[model samples]
Target: MNLKSNYLLFLVFLMSLGCATNPFTGKQTMAIVSNDQLFPASFKQYDEFLKENKVVEGTEDAARITRVGQRIAKAAERYLNANGYEGYLKGYQWEYHLIEDKTKNAWCMPGGKIVFYTGILPVAQTDAGIAAIMGHEVAHALANHGQQRMSAAYIQQGIAIAGNVAITDDESRDLFNQYYGVGSTVGAMLPFSRSHEAEADRIGIILMAIAGYDPAVAPELWKRMESSNTPEFLSTHPSNSSRIAQLSALVANARAEAKKFGVTGFTE
Candidate 1:
């Protein structure tokens, strides 16, 4: 990288620091990737995953997932449009799926490709329980966490690339890449996943409230999630107690957020 190119990259980095305020907390959030750059690949990958995965047929559960996802996606769109990100979702291909798996987990990939595992149905004890999980996962996708994780990995791999250039052989380059991959996954990805979990808990409350589910029930859903505390590696979520306390503190604020979305008559 020449001096001018290096300066240009730095300028790119600075320019990428676009700000979008969080509607729930009325706070600014750090966002690096633009929706213009981020949406296309996410849409492609989401379509590919749907084609490959065993997407559940439109059963009652599947319908529920789709319904909840659409509601949340719309609420998110309203938030973005209201806050001047009017075209942020112009290319977003929102999707939802329910898979017949027994693992107590659910996730929404980038570009709104969501999955609900049958195994998690027990933990998601009710419609509200499902809403809790949906809110959290939708928040992750909306916040561009998947792209941020990839960007963080790119930085780690870039350092390994630097190390490889100093070495003599392709074998050494492969070794460094392997090490970088492992180190990034264990060190950066886990912590990043944990942060997503925490942020989801916080953001999820307001989302659920805005969608008119009782945000107070958020803690109760977390209590159910607590029943299975696998190792941190096995489970990417925060501990139950942590989520419970966090959501409890945000109930008032979640209600306040609900009003912004015109959600009234929510349970206290």
Candidate 2:
């Protein structure tokens, strides 16, 4: 077998071992970095971030952020327990904070540590809008998107290393770098990231609904995001227009899903 064939076989083996089933998607995803390894490190990083940043506390917005986060977490717990995923979050230590920042963003770390920037509050506007963003951020953690991203990065690196070893000519190597850089990133990686974003959106709307927040307002939050003007293909996130459309379509289904948990009369 040639070097290329050996590399191909090795990659296939790695992919097989890295696959794990995501309950939300009911599909296998890459998880080479296990929660046991990722969670502690993420928790430490989150602590360091809080220590270095101005975290708002004892205010109405900060209190709301925490309240919404707890509700979302409870919703996730209800879904997981009902779906035979009991103790799925056994190792998770959930924490939520509102950070003082002008950047319109929020994120959840690997083990349920979440932060909401103040700039996003204006876009969020109301309790339901905040729940929309909160649910999306928490969904990323619940789906283990962080571990999947790490695993994907490792795969991308391995492929690049294989190319370097198999191709001998320096000029050929330069061409390979050029094409592979664009092809692997735009063709493979960006799509992977975008899919995660969409999955988060789907899971998020459902969780918000289950938590007694109106899922219908999710599209409105994205509609507010549409002013950012980033194109879908080039960005890590799907276009705001695409997100809005998807959320609009998912609202009824999300509401129905919430009903299974005895959750009714969503609040707008």
- Residue range 128-157, candidate 1, lDDT tens digits: 678888989888877777766666555555
Question: In model 1, where do residues sit more than 4 Å from their true spots?
Answer: 1-38, 163-189, 226-236
Write down the lDDT of every candidate, Cα atoms only: 0.75, 0.92
Overall local distance difference test of candidate 2: 0.92
In model 2, the Cα lDDT at residue 187 comes to 94
Q: Write the per-residue lDDT of candidate 2 for residues 87-123, one digit (tens) a residue.
A: 9888999999999999999999999999999999999
Clashing pairs in 1: none
Instruction: Write out the backbone clash pairs for model 2.
Output: none
